[model samples]
Target: MHVKDVMTTRVVRISPDNSVRQAARMMFDNNVSGVPVVDDQGQLVGIISEGDLIRRTELCSGTPSPADTGLAPDEIAAAYVKRCSWRVGDAMTPDPVSIDEDASVTRAARIMHERGIKRLPVLRNGELVGIISRWDLLQAVLSARQDDLPAGDDAIRRSVLARLGDNTGLEGLNVTATVSDGIVHLWGNVETAGCRRAARLLAENVRGVRGVVEHFPDPYPR
Candidate 1:
């Protein structure tokens, strides 16, 4: 699926000229952790999030000095501005990462994971069309339909064997499966208890599977 399929069209935005207090209130009232900062022409300029606001001087007792942080004078000054600035423009994260509306949901998720971000502003032709968050991706997962599997004991056995061989952690192990009356019987020389359990689960999850029986030799044989 694509990002546009799950993105939220109603985005709560804030102006760069808005006060820090206003930005905080907007987030609180909207029940959001961040707001996209826009310019007079409705162009996305930056983003202010709870992470940015938590560093404000009002929330802290004191700011760290350059000597304590071992940071350069300019770096310390920039951090000071982020912590003490009144305008959202100076405090917000500039040139924030964004995703195209037509991009795949997998790509969007990868970007968010790599950047350690919770949301991305979905843009169309360099203009903000909507926003996609981790929550939205989760909703898509919850609504997705499971792949239809073929019925019958033979199909179930094939599926179980294929699953075991297809990166199910039982790969390379001497595992075999037989199905009768929709019940699967797994046999193999799996050394680890985890792999044995994995084989059982792999068979149990296949469609038309009613029960799973393991016939592997005990690891702690006397």
Candidate 2:
């Protein structure tokens, strides 16, 4: 699926001129963790997340003085900005990671994971069009899963074992399958990637099977 299929189009965005306090209030009111900061042209410029607001001077006291930390002037200045900045332009993370609206869901997932971020701003023609969150991706997966009919455990076990024995051509392989609550647990050793994929496919295609749990052994080093 594409990001556009799952992204929330009615995004809550803020201008760079907005106060940090106002941004935090918006996030709390909307129950969102972050908000994209936009320019006058409505182009995405940055993002202010909860992480950005957590260190505000208003929230905490007893911070070490710049002299006590023995930090360089530049480092001290940067710290002061993070603690004292009130506007989104100064407090937000600039040039935040974003994905195209037409990008694949897999791409969005990868980017979010690699960056340790929970959301991705979806852009079209360099304009913020939507936002995709981890929750949205999970919902898409669950929705797809709901379309599959549940198969009986006994039927799943028998059919999956049969397919593995006949179709996989993994001679002398000892693959066993057990099913409970429509989930198949496959345990075995496969010599090749194709064999592993075939085994999973067989189990997944079986009627009444809700999911596959593979417990294949680690392959010995060649």
Candidate 3:
């Protein structure tokens, strides 16, 4: 499914000029971890999240001095602004990662996994159209329809044999099957007990299959 198919169109946004306190309150009230930071023209500028808010001066006891960490003067100054700044523009993370609205759900999930992020802003033509979260992907999985399996004894027998020959580890193992009244009889020259078990399972999982009976020569026959 495409990201547009599952993404949330009703996104809560924040302005860069807004107070940091406002951003925090918005997140709390909306039950969201973050919100996209937009500019005057409604262009996405950055994003403010719980991670960013946690670094604020109000939450910490004190800021580490540059001399203690041996940080460059500019780096220390930037860190100070992030911790003490009141404006969301100064505290939010800039140039946040985003995904296109037309992108596949799989791509969105992959990007989230690789970046260790929980959500992504969905854009279209440089405009924020929606947002996709890990929860949306999970909902998609739960709502997806199950595939219709083959019906009837003949069809089930065909499916089992086809699966066994198609990269099912039993390929070219002299395996074969027949069906009678939804019951399957597996006949083959499987070398290992595992192979015999695999054949039985393959047949059992086929649609319309009621039971499986294996008819194979014992490898340990003396």
Off by over 4 Å in 1: 65-68, 146-222
Task: Please list the residue runs of candidate 2 whose C-alpha ends up more than 4 Å from where it truly belongs after superposition.
Answer: 62-71, 145-222
lDDT of 1 by residue, 1-222 (tens): 899999999999999989999999999999999999988877788999999898787888557644438887798878888879899999999999999999999899989998999999998887888999999999987886666564799988888877776567887678998899998998887878789878878887787889998898888889
The residue pairs that clash in candidate 3, if any, are none
lDDT of all predictions: 0.88, 0.85, 0.88
lDDT of 2 at 141: 79
Tens digits of per-residue lDDT for model 2 on 85-192? 888898898999999999999789988988999999999999999999999999887786533544577866877876665435654678889998988898877757
Clashes of each: 0, 4, 0
Candidate 3: tens digits of C-alpha lDDT, residues 1-222: 899999999999999999999999999999999999988777888999999988788988557644437787798888888889899999999999999998999899989999999999998987888999999999998886546577788998899988886456888778888899999999887879788888888898777889998889878889
TM-score of each: 0.67, 0.66, 0.67
Cα error, candidate 1, residue 91 (Å): 0.8
Task: Arrange candidates by TM-score, descending.
Answer: 1, 3, 2
Error of 2 at 196 (Å): 6.7
Q: Pick the candidate with the highest lDDT.
A: 3
